[model samples]
Target: MTAGHVPVAVVGGGQAGLSVSWYLGRAGVEHVVLEAQTPVHAWADTRWDNFTLVTPNWHCRLPGYAYDGEDPDGFMTRDEVVQWLAGWLQTFTPPLRNHTRVSTLRPLAAGGFELTLATATGEEVLTCEHAVVATGGYPIPVLPAFAASLDGSITQIHSEQYRNADQLPEGAVLVVGTGQSGAQIAEDLHLEGRQVHLAVGSAPRVARFYRGRDCMTWLADMGLYDKAAPEYPGGKAAIEKTNHYVTGRDGGRDIDLRRFAVEGMRLYGTLSDGKDARLTFEPSLRHALDKADAVYNSILSDIDAFIEREGLGRSVPPATRYSTVWEPDAEVTELDLAAEGITSIVWAIGYRPDYRWIEASAFDGGGRPMQNRGVTEVEGLKFVGLPWMHTWGSGRFLGVDRDARYLADNIIDAHQRKSALESSALRASAHHHLAVAR
Candidate 1:
């Protein structure tokens, strides 16, 4: 075991972890970040080949760094994002120990924690006054229950596994989930000349455009996205709930789902009596389609107003809509891989936070750790980059910057107080021993 201690040890090297490390460096705090892979490795590896960020370049900045370039509103491709992060790391020069996987973390007798890290050569024990688990969620992918019942002859793949349209079978592909990933993946497959069927679930309410001289502009002007203090009540819960998932707003100029429907994508709702048995769209699907269109229109209206105000005519293009219901060019059916010869099933549902490495009893029945702002009930432990760690924006790229600063200040204060107490206790014990000798 290596005999050394650091003031703070951060696990995970994604956006959240890097943000914390940036602030820690600015504060001149001695710390080391442990990352199992290169920074932003998940985004670099998992996204489909045609994927681009829904958020514009401006919103993607980490703490103490802004996305450097002229095109603030330009969306970065997956590879571009990875390259930018690599460059940003060079500018900040955060002390990150790559390939060091932390196996477990336990509290020590004094105020701090002992982290067990597995390295390339051997196991190493490292202690820090505070342990920050900055592992952002989204690594573990969830699949639907019906997937297992399908015959083994059919090829199935989650959205995370999909890289491009070439991997899919020649016949129609059924894409589950209508979230940003699902919508984008379906669109990409359709572009590649494969018939695509989208399984509509609870659809997300999304903005139509990235930004313009309207509410979004106003929000940015007022610095609404900036980090803030944690003193506000109920602030933390709000921040945690703010969805970070991509949405329809990221579509480049002129693209609209209604227009895509008119051209040919099939939208299906929950299966009905015997329709699903035969792999067909449910009878009730028509009603659900109507409802989804209404939501889409509302988003489009807001976008239209913003476009006019900004005079971004060249950048913004007109959207299209399907005036009437149209049957699929191919056919919309329930996913039965074996019978239909379907090659892939993209699970665009979402991600679950896995905190198994944390053995502390601080977690509730739901597996969420109970914390007051960033402070947990357990001492010497803190959390950052959690949804709503303090306020509505707490977990946002802009929001997390604020929480990290506040958390750093609180940790510094706690460290000083604990040091003073330990010194006082040692002096008192020495005096008592001397008196006893006399």
Candidate 2:
């Protein structure tokens, strides 16, 4: 059977897809957005009830919809974020298909591409001149293989699966990994008076506010957010660095794991292995905490230097530094889970990208798409929302529009070139016919 066709097929209907659609619509490009789930479902469904954006509201800039809420500096709750995205959808009204899953995306031998989709009704095929994979980077949750060895009596959940402390059985909880989600979720449980034991990873921490303004504001002024991925200190490998942990909960604050230690929360090093009733950890908690502090202080020093260099020292608060509040006395390597009465374990390690459905030969040996600022070597194939796809903010709300605009421009250029070539061919054919008639 013949399949449906379009000029473009956008694979995800999240912010990335919507932003690209906005620009495409403005250019009069005919396209369809296929979403595996409902639009903005991640914001509406994946997050915990008390979850708020780590970044401030002003950063919520989609193509034409910038945040105009009363609280620009304040963070938006999960509900607010969902509502904000929905508002953008209403503005342009792109051709969106929810609950349509793209099972396979492969290049066509005849040109363009083919997408086999499984919708609620049944299976369908689509052919498109261009395909935009805006699925974002983090798709699959990751946990250690040892996670399965834990006692079945104890509850276990990934950070994405966690909602609140009350959902777990009443007892102490062991939260592993100190990334953004792990740190914040640990705080969530600790605040509720739950006994929390946190396994600290090497993820760095940054102060929420510095020198009379939000730390993000300081970084923005210093052009940290605008830094290109290639220009990063460690090169392309730097893009894989874990984000510095902080919090926007309770109207924004620093996540001081040290202070949490002082406040009775237990802290350990990275979790290494787990057995039926026992878990072991590497003795690196002290090193991890110190390393996080070093990054925090490094940022402060850079900002201070910027203030001095820009001659704006008097305008902002006097330069200050963080002093260690508490330290681990000794490395604690093992924990008896059953004896400690720990009823639940929350694994907040991180996520891995899942591109198994993409059957294109456009990836590197590491499975990452080989692209230059969203443009791939393969004709008419592009990716727009992966982390550090162009700049540090490429995948973020602050920069997705720029990436989309770039890709949209490329699509428009291709269309114009094709039209010109066809017109030139028509002129040549007309001349040949006239000569034959003479």
Candidate 3:
């Protein structure tokens, strides 16, 4: 069967895909973006109603689109973010086929790509020289298997499914994972008069306002966000997990587990297991905090080194580390969720991309999409927002655009090269014909 052809087929309509599309459009490339949901569906659908961007407005650097709002330093709320993305779509008017979910993306034996999509109308097939999967930072929410072992009486929700406190049933909330979303949700529930228990791990935190500048500002000044994964003191391992983590509430304040502990929120080590109406936890809270502190200090040290080397001597706030002051092992290990009246469990375990649709040899053994930056093993196949796609900020709002730009440039160069080859071949044929006539 003949498939509709385009130079490029962009899968996913979120910021990543859209950003890539924007670049392609600018370069006059023929491409179609396939969006499963509306643009920015992640923020519009999955995120909580009260969610706000952890990064400040200034850091939301969409290519050719800057945040032109009254508060550059202020964080944008969920709706505002959606609106911005929707507006970006409107401005560029990228060729977006909405409600089109790609069922399969595989390299054809002949050449190029074969795409099968279930769109609003019906099933459709497409062929493109290049394929860009901007599907998501990760495919599905990372949920712990132990969640199912809990008593059926307790309502458990992945951070992705959670809406707001109003929707949750009455009782204490056991928010799992001390990462960004987990910490923010726990703090929100705690401050909103809900007894919150955070299952802490070695998730780091940085003060929103560090020294005389914002944390992001300092990082930017020091080129931390732009640094490639290999440049980190922790090396590529530092970016193996979710590299971005910051709280947006309290007007862009730091919401670490230790701070949550001091503020009356119960902090426990990792939720090791659940069995027979009992929950087991790792006795590593202090170790976790130390690890978290280490990351923060590492970053700050980098900034300090930058300041010293550049001769930009700027006085900064003194370092103030949060002390847990509580023994992790001694803290309540086994807790009966039902007996403790824990009505809700917010699992903020994190996310992993679902590239099952892709049949190309572009993913690694661990299922992570493998590529040299955005360029994959399969020629003309690329990924835009995977963790460490190119840099620490690769999966971030400010970084996706850069990755998109690179992918677009890469595709365009290939196209030009193809065109050049064809032109040279045609010229050779013409000269041969003339020679034969003579």
**Winning candidate number (TM-score):** 2
Off by over 4 Å in 1: 1-4, 210-255, 270-341, 391-395, 419-438
- Candidate 2 lDDT tens digits, 159-189: 9998988999999999999998999999999
- Residue 242 of model 2, lDDT score: 89
In candidate 2 the C-alpha lDDT for residue 165 amounts to: 86
Arranged by lDDT with the best first, the candidates are 2, 3, 1
**Which whole-number lDDT from 0 to 100 does residue 212 have in model 1?**
45
The models' CA-based lDDT, in order, is: 0.67, 0.91, 0.80
- What is the lDDT for 71 in model 1? 68
Q: Sort every candidate by TM-score, greatest first.
A: 2, 3, 1
Compare the candidates by lDDT and give the number of the best one.
2
Residue 113 in candidate 1, Cα distance off native in Å: 2.0
Position 158, candidate 3: lDDT:
88
For model 1, how does the per-residue alpha-carbon lDDT over 1-438 read when each residue is reduced to its tens digit?
565689889888877777778877876778899998878798878888888866556766666677878767667788888888787787787789999998989888776888999889888999988888887644568775666665554456888888888876667787876666877787788788877766765553344343443223334544445434354334655344323223323434423455567767666665322222134445445554455555545555555565567776577456444344453344354544446545556667766767788777777786776776677887767777876566556656556677777777777677668779999999999999999999
TM-score of each: 0.78, 0.97, 0.93
